[model samples]
Target: MAFVPAPGYQPTYNPTLPYYKPIPGGLRVGMSVYIQGVANEHMKRFFVNFVVGQGPGADVAFHFNPRFDGWDKVVFNSQQDGKWGNEEKKRSMPFRKGAAFELVIMVLPEHYKVVVNGDPFYEFGHRIPVQLVTHLQVDGDLTLQSINFIGGQPAPSPGPMPNPGYPGPGKHNQQPCNLPCMEGAPTFNPPVPYKARLQGGLVARRTIVIKGYVPPSGKSLVINFKVGSSGDVALHINPRLTEGIVVRNSYLNGKWGAEERKSSFNPFAPGQFFDLSIRCGLDRFKVYANGQHLFDFSHRLSNFQGVDTLEIQGDVTLSYVQI
Candidate 1:
């Protein structure tokens, strides 16, 4: 995986407009992204909608409309009423039980590809003209925690070309480097397949601060270490999953499992960093490319909660993992 470093967009939480706005002009017609939030009755009013052409309000709202009498009668809504017919796909926001749900959506030339809880939820084909999509909407009552764009600049945009002190990849910036931190510090304690333990390595953290890289790149950086039957590598960070960083995994073998969720990548590459950070949400995992997001597994698995510890095997290194 080759990570192209660039400025990213900071999450803007405006209750009045709803939805977090990504970097201006950063959104494309065929781009995909992940939106983390909770769903419930109040969510019926709140939706991930889009607006274009200097509209007075939202151009259209794409809520969970069950009784939508359209081609796809499942997740579409046309009744305009906040309430729509329900389906198995329709779920109570993950935040209700204090759990967070992540949504993966794509911007097609014509529709919005929507995936909920790491699964393909639905595809909205009502073409909102890429130029018209000046803003992304999140209405209803659910709290908007984080909005992560899959692939783009490494750092959030400097806002209208003002350009902050942010530099591109390869630039040397003062980061968390040369410390006592070891790869897979004491944050890992989960059991692996066939009774293998995830805490059987050197048990020390190697602190390597990746300078000049805001949302670290998926390529260029690699965390090499040893592996076991469980063969899982984790990048432990704060306790919340709302952190604004995405990890891209390319080289790997066997199945990949993190804290709350688990998934598969490809053949192992001896040493590689594939898991992204979920702020305080320990074990929140995803595959990345460049500084973009690819796939999101589960939220928090019981076996790996409070997993502020990151354990890696098979030639791994701990670089720029937020403490």
Candidate 2:
């Protein structure tokens, strides 16, 4: 099937062979891309390029090529002003011929963090700020399934942002939960209508980050922070895109509660990316999208103990649920 990208998004060519993608605004901190596909059964090599322009011989910020033609290693390098740099070789290949793979590339301030099939793979030090790279090129012995990019300059901080703890719990009454290290943060990939136990349940200042794309055919997306056992939704962030509004409500003992549908702006759009965050405050749940404070849903349920499980369902493709 042909690949259909979102409006203003780059499209892939010859899905089974090679393709070049244009990064409209380029890559920067907070930007991550997910690539899902397979290596050819008799694959020899494949390359994914981060380049500055669409023209030939343009500077390449980073070049990632994995070879399996007997010389089994991944080569990484960079080109600037037309001069090629020394090649850095990584001596591991986690890919199998003809096997499917899920790769995530996260652009940080210093380097490009790569995760292959959900595990730490390699870190390619940035030869240049990746944000300046304007195009992404993929080619060689691979069958491209899908290439997706998400994230952008976060919504300007609504106010002072809260800095949370890492790989551990947070203290009470913290304003925000800005994690210092992305690698140390816990991540989850639950099934749709997903529900998972939040270790030690909820604590003040604890936070959750959900990243995903709004489906092109999306109607609305709903996220509920509630007691896993009793199914009481404490903060139900229901963005009813069809109505051009977000409806925040709760469910108690299986009955829907009064809705909190007021918002300063509608932060969602079909075929866009959203980084929805919810942080536990002393008396209420603080919600933010892209970084802008959306609103709050005060404590409602009798037992806040069940803030242990997070449930999300709707027309969205979740990249992860990081707590």
lDDT of each: 0.35, 0.68
- What is the TM-score of each predicted model, taking all chains together? 0.39, 0.52
Runs of candidate 1 exceeding 4 Å displacement: 1-17, 20-23, 40-44, 53-58, 61-99, 152-323
- Give the Å error, residue 281, model 1: 23
**Residue 51 C-alpha lDDT in model 2:** 82
Candidate 1, 153-209: lDDT as tens digits: 233344542122322221222234232222321222122110223333322222222
Highest lDDT: give the candidate number: 2
78-98: candidate 2 lDDT, tens digit per residue: 998889899999888988898
Compared with the true structure, the alpha-carbon lDDT of candidate 1 equals 0.35
- Which ranges of candidate 2 are over 4 A from the true structure? 1-17, 154-309, 312-319
